[model samples]
Target: MQPLPRHWATVRETVAFPNTQEYALTIHGASDLSLEDAQRDAQERMALLIASGGPGQLHDSGLEYYPLRRLPEELLEELRSPGGELIAAISRNRYGSAVLNTDALLISDVDLVEPSPQDRAKPAGGLLSRLFGGGRQAELTPEQQDPDAFGLPGLHRRGEHHERTLHLIEDFRARHPELGVRSYRTRNGFRLLVTGTGAGPSSKRARELMGQLRSDELYMILCRVHDSYRARLTPKPWRIEVDRFEDLGTRTSADETHHAWVARYRAASEDVAVCRLLDVSGPAPSAVEQQIIDLHDRAVRPESGLRLA
Candidate 1:
């Protein structure tokens, strides 16, 4: 899983070029770093940036070239198991809603809208691009090209996408009787939480299962990159008619403004639910899984009867 650094800090530096022009650069670090340590790290990185002719010269560089092992969100809380293992974490995403992050207990969502052929063929480009060169186009394997060939039912009719997606979920439940699946209805599609199968987000089994269930391709890529699964626990700001919170960058703590914003968001979101509980199938969740489910249910208010956001 991506390391959720307990500490964060930011450093700023001014670099002077040979042409007598100066540029200011800010860097954020999450390595439990002291101000001095962060400053030193920033200085080293800035020196390299200067050697490469500053930030202006690196317009073509892709994000894959950068080392990004830590999640770039503010950690709100951490959940642990009886044995002291970190089971889950709650973090404030950039859009101001809380997100649930877990290294275990697979969580995936299936969008209602199908991707176009071109979109489906696009490479995810993290470890996949590193293993197979970025220029290579992704080709659908036989199973992806023909899901029906693997005993999975295909959606044949128009406007039945929702029902067809549910059918796929039921098919998955029928095939994998050993795993427990909890389904919820989100505003855009369905959210699935699986248990009784101990597969980490980046595991091969997880990849295959998510693919078979038709989880969002970008979501799968993000899970693989971050080594974790994520689910939003709160309504989107716009959905609740609240403005987005300011981008806090790498600040270690929240201020009065952030607190006030959160207060308003919470108040507006009080009558809204993120998702509604649809059904549970397969088997009962284990003790640890139940703990996660409880936490998730509390945050989402699955039975609130309010409109999903």
Candidate 2:
């Protein structure tokens, strides 16, 4: 018997928190402006967003227009802990900002790789002057510095916490062959995907897998993808769903859906083949019977288009 594909409900909701933790809501671009002004803008915007809820609740607004130089040390400490949340530090200095999440949800353990001397030298002269004064220069140890200190741009140091989390996922996949994995790069880090079929033991088995993620040190997280498909027979009346690997949620149907016999080329000489799976249907379809047929068909001609040529 073949397992039926489950329909996952699409959520347009956000994760809820019981309390505001010690995390720093980082806001970028405010480096040019005064910290007080930046904080005021962030607070006002956050209040408004919270009041008018929708997609706003789903996204992290904690870091909007945050002031960096005047950031409090206590907040910095929270940013380093596993439970600490760093809102709105732009990853890769991209156009906008994002939350810097820790694997343990503790922010203090987060460590940024130091920038190169050229990058470090770019800091305002006043900060440089402070580094030279007050005998506080000793606190600026190499190990304690950010990755930008090493002159490597856009390099993030995955503290022990995050590394352990990733390994746990890889380890789980190794133990389970039927499972599929997908990954996507995010502003602060990467997003992981874990998917499989069946119920009973299969669904129950996810708990153990989830435990590994919770206990691991890595800050990355897992999210399930949802999809919908309309039935050709019923048209408006019937629909079905299947879970598939997706890199990011930003793809349009044209970009995500594959066409048979399409050749995608990176360069004039480089060649790559693109193929999409086609649904097989007649007057009636059986999930159990067709699954076997699909398996056999795939085995016989895995590279062929869904339709007969």
Q: Give the candidate number with the greatest lDDT.
A: 1
Q: For candidate 2, lDDT tens digit of each residue in 1-309?
A: 111111111112132434532322332212124556545654554444445342233345553222221221101111221333321111110111111211211111112223346645664444343444443443544422333122334222233223444455456556755644443222222233333423221233433554544422221221111011001100010011212113223212244332110111112112211112222112222233233323223322324422111
Strongest candidate by TM-score? 1
Please state the error at residue 278 of candidate 1 in Å. Answer: 0.8
Q: After superposition, how far is residue 61 of candidate 1 from its true place, in Å?
A: 11
Encode model 1's per-residue lDDT on 1-309: one tens digit a residue: 344755544556678767546877665555434556544554565556666555655434533313322334678888888888788888888778899998768998987545456644765664334333465745544323332112234422112345557778888889999999999978767899999778888789899999989888878877876778999999999888998764533333457677778889999998888888889988888777888899999999999877778
Q: Which ten residues in a row have the lowest lDDT in candidate 1?
A: 142-151
Model 1's alpha-carbon lDDT is: 0.72
